[model samples]
Target: MLHILGLTANFSLTLQHKDQDILNVMSLVESTKRELQKLRDDGWDSLMAKVASFCKKHNVEMLIMEENFVDLRNPRKRTNISNMHHYKVNCFCTVLDFQIQEFKDRFTEVTTDLLICMAALSPIDSFHGFDKDKPVRLAKLYPDDFSYGELLSLEQQLDIYIDNIRRDERFKSVENLGDFSCLMVKTQKHLAHPLVYKFLKLVLILPVATASVERCFSAIKLVKTAARNRIGDQFLSDCMVCFIEKELFDSISNEKVIKKFQMMNERRVVL
Candidate 1:
């Protein structure tokens, strides 16, 4: 799963398994750790690689959230300077003006006939919390038109867009489906992608929980020996690689176990 900017946007992989969840959980934990480390080091390129690897191994699919200007920390990135006894660390977000130049360069280097990208010039998180860091310039790796203004909420914009598209002759019968919603269900529904909603609807109705992912992480910690005191990057990675790839014990096959226990009680074999 690709979790972008906290709980705001994310992607989850699915493998249609009947009973064994432990194996799936372990894979998730391991893959997540890898992705995080890679993102910090190599940016989007590395992120895509990890995402592909995880999906392939589990026989699953992936979706990526567009961390466009409207969503990611654009002009409102935080910065601070902390000093040691003799050393100081100045940490700041990738500023826009610099990023703009880089973006232009990327356009020049691309070999594709069609390069489509989602672009929006807006604040990071405007609907919820109040932030004090009013940004001036931000890092740009793409040629983004940075517009500052009182912007429309996502819901309002989407409503208009949907209205325009729904009138098209393409959507003949399912016209009302465009508005089919229980807006009161405040749980964040990622309608950005229809497949996400489909996946969520199924998951909500199922008795299954993410218990398997937890089990794998538990096994990860257990596999850590004292020699690996801190459970460093290498060990964590190895554990995930080993765990996620393994086939878990099937629950339906437990009839043998049940029958064996039943047979142990020779005095009371109730047919």
Candidate 2:
């Protein structure tokens, strides 16, 4: 179990990479799914051998695979299953299957499609990730933002946009979506390709820095408690911002806060 779990743990760490582009992240996810499936099909024998070696080295008793299984929780209880069934099917196979299903469940067809579409907008590799169809599909996902006529316009713009961006020297060195968006605005490309820029804005809204968003939501739960259910919107917003950005807020001196507060109102007793 540890051996199987250790493999998935490494995959988990790989997914946590801060600098990985969305395209690479999706590829890693797909590769992990295949790897886990392959491991399930052919890893049992190798896993068993490793377990046996560890048992022998530690002077641990080893059970025969063919022997009738005994339940450790209830020794008096009789079971018809073999030790191999209990260890392999009940433990190893179960764990692997659950992880495989989890990967499948997490990256469903819609989510995968969305990521692929989003990847098309990635500026890494000199706009090599650009796909005309995927970005159209991405725009289609947001029907409210893109009308039927706008979709057709977007396709035409995409043709010109890719050609323009690839040849343009300004965007040649741009890497990642954040830098791409900033550079696009810097060069006023957003004005030239309004629809594509809108799509880029939508993509930028997605939580690329996932840890910060998660921390913000967790901070909200703590700040907006039952006692503070009636907290005003502006006050809640300020409190939540301070709570989430503790380090930044911590650097703010109390004297500075008092001075700022004093400036906000004409206090008769001025400090």
Candidate 3:
């Protein structure tokens, strides 16, 4: 169990990209299956012998034995060290088989394709490693948002955009889609790659998990406690926005806030 857990912890650390994460997890599943099979074949006997030896050496062999011993005279009722090893191996194999099946079922072909498409926005390798077809497939998946013309133009736009980004020293260190988008916005480069910017917008809004939404609900529950149960919908929304994006909210100047509030309605006292 400790060995399995240690492997899991190591794999968890490499879960940076969605597509890569899926591949890593599948690889881990395969590796674990192979390990378990090997254990069942030969490792179990070796491990059991070593464990038995250790227990004997420490004079604690009785700790592993059953409280009531079965009669060795009756072959059907007797349980020996070999039987114990077999039982352990069978149990381990069963658990590993179930885990491998679960991993395969969870990461289907469609899921893999979607993740690979999403990972196309990675800014490494001068954006030359970008999977052009995957993003096209991604755009096709959302016809309502991306028109046929826009989808067709994405490839051309990506070619120009990637070339321009690679040539510009400022964009060399851009690590991910979010950073690339921010740089484009800051430099007003969206005009140069309109289609690419549109694609970036679509990618930015894609929800990776429901945990963030759930966290918002949890925050709402905490914020709208008994003492503040009667908060209006607009006020509650504002509070939630402030709570969720507290860093952005904190950056606003008091004067700017006061000026904005004064502009909204007439006030008796003006700052």
Best model number under lDDT = 2
Instruction: Give the alpha carbon lDDT tens digit for every residue of 1-271 in model 2.
Output: 6666666776667555555566677787788888888889999998888889999999999998999999999988989999999988998889889989998998888888888888888788887767899989888988899999999999999999999989999888887888988988999999999988998999888645465566677788899999999999999999988887778888999999999999998999976
- Backbone-clash count (model 3): 0
Against the unseen true structure, what C-alpha lDDT does each candidate score?
0.37, 0.85, 0.70
Worst 10 residues of 1 by lDDT: 112-121
- Candidate 1, residues 1-271: lDDT per residue as tens digits? 2233331122133423433232233444445445444444456455457768989999986543332222134546432322221111111112222333443453342211111111111111221111112111111111232223212232234444344434544333321211222221232334442322332233233333344655666777667768767877886887776666566534335677677777887755442
Cα RMSD for candidates in order: 23.6, 3.5, 7.2
lDDT of 3 at 197: 87
- Candidate 3 minimal-lDDT segment of 10 residues: 14-23
- Every model's TM-score: 0.20, 0.80, 0.60
Rank the models by TM-score, top first.
Answer: 2, 3, 1
Superposition error at 63 for model 2 (Å):
1.3
Task: Order the candidates by lDDT, highest first.
Answer: 2, 3, 1
TM-score of 3: 0.60
